[model samples]
Target: MPYARLLPPILLVFSNVFMTFAWYGHLKYRDTALPKVILASWGIAFFEYLLMVPANRLGSTVYSAPQLKGMQEVITLLVFAGFSAWYLGQPLKWNHWAGFALIVAAAWLIFLE
Candidate 1:
């Protein structure tokens, strides 16, 4: 298989890692000033967009828009699940697994011809 097809998902994984931090990492620092937290999140989000934009562009070469989006969502959840557990100390519940399973099923449908 061509390695170019792997670039998008790899980049998306990195992008989602940054995004999960940008979006929820602040929860651990809720005592910090809101403006400072917002600024910090924005800074983190900048890196996320840098990877995310290219991931989508490259992914478009091998996948449709919906497929790319579905892939990204799945990557996002996977990244967030780890971040939530390790960084935020929030473990996944049974419901979270069930919800994620549904999303995975949706991704399967998106990838199906």
Candidate 2:
């Protein structure tokens, strides 16, 4: 458990990847049936939960719940940024970066002692 502090964030990053896909990966498949997409998203979310639950459980040991949430939020944005540009073919605009920067700054505040 030497990597306790580091591990949770890494796990969260992976978890968020799955979550982002589960939530948004269907955008490109607009013609797909709603029920089919829902089922697929659920399948993807199962994996997300697998990683997310452990990430939270382990993160609680080294970080407060707020801090862990902060970490996950930031990681979600970062992962989504990449997935947006590369997978969804939608790059973030400058305004989006500005908004995310502010959010990240707010997350930093939670980490302050």
Clashes of each: 0, 0
User: Model 2's lDDT to the true fold?
Assistant: 0.96
Clashing pairs in 1: none
Tens-place lDDT per residue, model 2, 1-113, is 79999999989999999999999999999999999999999999999999999999998999999999999889999999999999999999999999999999989999999
Error of 2 at 83 (Å): 0.5
Give a tens-digit lDDT track for model 1, residues 67-93: 999999899999999999999999999
- Where model 2 places Cα greater than 4 Å from the true spot, the runs are none
Model 1: lDDT equals 0.94
Worst 10 residues of 2 by lDDT: 68-77
Q: TM-score winner among the candidates?
A: 2
For model 1, the superposed segments whose C-alpha errors exceed 4 Å read none
